[model samples]
Target: MHNATVIALRTVATILILATFVPLLPFEAWYIRIFDFPRSQIFVLAAFTLLIFLVLRWWRYGIDKILIPGLVASLVFEAVNIYPYTFLSPVQVQQAPADAPADGQLSILVSNVYQHNVEHQLLIDLIQEHSPDILLTLETDSIWQKGLRPATDSFPERVAIPLSNTYGMHLYSKLPLRQTRTRYLLEEEVPSIKTYVQLRNGVWVELHAVHPKPPVPTEDDDSKTRDAEIVLVGKEVKGSDYPVIVAGDFNDVAWSHTTTLFQKVSGLLDPRIGRGFYNTFNAKYKLLRWPLDHVFHSDHFKLVKMERLPHINSDHFPILAILSFAPENKYEQEEPQPDEDTAEEAAETIEEGKEEAQEEDD
Candidate 1:
């Protein structure tokens, strides 16, 4: 009985340690990249294992000395990735002052209404209640488009792409949207919206609404296409003359390597930094959730208010962000800039995505 217990503890410790380092591999395979989602869960399990080890006084077993170090290292790695999202870290995007001008403010709501969940009235009611200046919805089909008409009617300007493929997106804005274009950046079926939104203050801000494909067995074999699309958008936003805001269900975690790289490449700031995770996905499963939906903006904007909204009969919850466009104070917030190596890596990833996409099409 004693021998069996020791072996069980050793096996569990080994699995946890390996899981922590699996994502470090330079691979895009779904099996490996999927490990990127549950860093917090892994941390908890590692901590629990370490406690059990100490409680059992397993150090007397000698082998535990080796396993203990591995567990500690895993905990440290996960902590480093999760720390920036906690309040203990410095905020990457500054908050707007209490006296921030109302005219310079813009509120956005982003939701991925699971396509088959037809409780449209719940979302409609939520929309009517919040009344954001801009609304972006993913997984909208023809039925969803019609179902959301009551709420969307209030938004005078819009871009609607209704498809059954679950990648359909719709962007409705109370503020005027100019030069709106629906782009199939990498995959033909997947669409992204790019446009300039004229804020109430008459300042033009570039907005990109995207719902990139996820790395899952049912979706794609790997994350190359998704990473490429994000990087492509990042590269484009890097040179934008106007202040930029990119928001949607990223299908990637806020703390993942791809997201970090995107920030560096685009010079965008995430308001969640030093705030909270604001986990939006897996609304159905509290224990298994992460911040897959994101809203990233240029330093020109300061966060006024950001919150995760109530679930509206979907697998994912909505996120609302009220930001004040304060370009004058942009210099106060440090922007993430990509070094030469990062730029080269981003370029290579984009090229690879394009090649893979072309090959798939062929």
Candidate 2:
């Protein structure tokens, strides 16, 4: 009975360890893609398994020795992936000086208001309390737009694309908007908003709001479309001289390969790096939570404040960030740069998207 128990535990441990590799596969099947969302859970499971095996003296010679080490390795691997997002890691985006002029500051609030959710007042209250300079909401249909209308009246510049398919987006800003464009990037259903906002200091900062479809059995069979959309945006911002801020519910994890590539190609910096995952999704399930909503900015700005706001009856908790434009400190933070191989991969992703578009046209 004792040996049998050990064998069962060992088997379960092996499965947990191997599950981590599913996300590493180049394929984009929903099952494979989902494995990328639970690195923290995997780490916990691996650690528990390792502890149990150690207590059972499973490392006392035989194949148990090999299995024990394997478990250790698996635990270590997950830890490494999550370490960068923790406070222990070096800060990726430097904090703004306490005395930084208010004229150079900008606060943004991003929320993925689940379309079916009807708690509009909660969201409205949250927004009123924070009163960010810019607000972007995702999954907003006509109902959400109507519900939010009263609160948004205060925002002088607004971009509302109301849709029923859960891909709806809205941008409300108090700052003056110049040269704003609403685009249906790859999929006609998935829309993105790009605009230049004149900051308080009279400096214009480029902002892009996107909410890509997730790799799921129902929404999208693979991540191709989502990856392509992000890559194309990265390509657009690659050589731009303007200070940029990209915000949205990316539906992708912070540690995923595609997000890393996007950051590198676009030269944007994720403030979450070394600042904790700030997991925003699966608000009801603690174990299933991961950072899906993000705010990536150019190195020309420094972090003023970042917080995961209280849940407003949505699956995602809104994220708010305040950034101070400091061109002089641009070089203080290291920007992500794509290597030759990564650049080629980004190009290929963009090309694949164009080809998909051509096929649709044909």
Whose lDDT is greatest here? 1
**Candidate 2 lDDT tens digits, 242-305:** 9999999889998888898999899999998888999999998888999999999999899999
**What's the alpha carbon RMSD for model 2?**
1.7
Candidate 2 least-lDDT 10 residues = 352-361
Deviating ranges (above 4 Å) for candidate 1: none
Candidate topping TM-score:
1
Clashing pairs in 2: none
Clashes of each: 0, 0
Can you write out model 1's per-residue Cα lDDT over 1-362, one digit (the tens) per residue? 39898799899999999999999999999999999999898999999999999888876777788899999999999999999989999999998999999999999999999999999999999899999999999999999999999999999998999999999899999999889999999999999999999988899999999998999999989999999999999999999999999999889999898999999999999999999999998999999999999999999999999999998989999999999999888999999877779988999989988988898899
RMSD (Å) of each candidate, 1 decimal: 1.1, 1.7
Model 2 ranges off by over 4 Å? 1-4, 61-63, 354-362
Each candidate structure's TM-score, on Cα atoms with residue i matched to residue i, is 0.98, 0.96
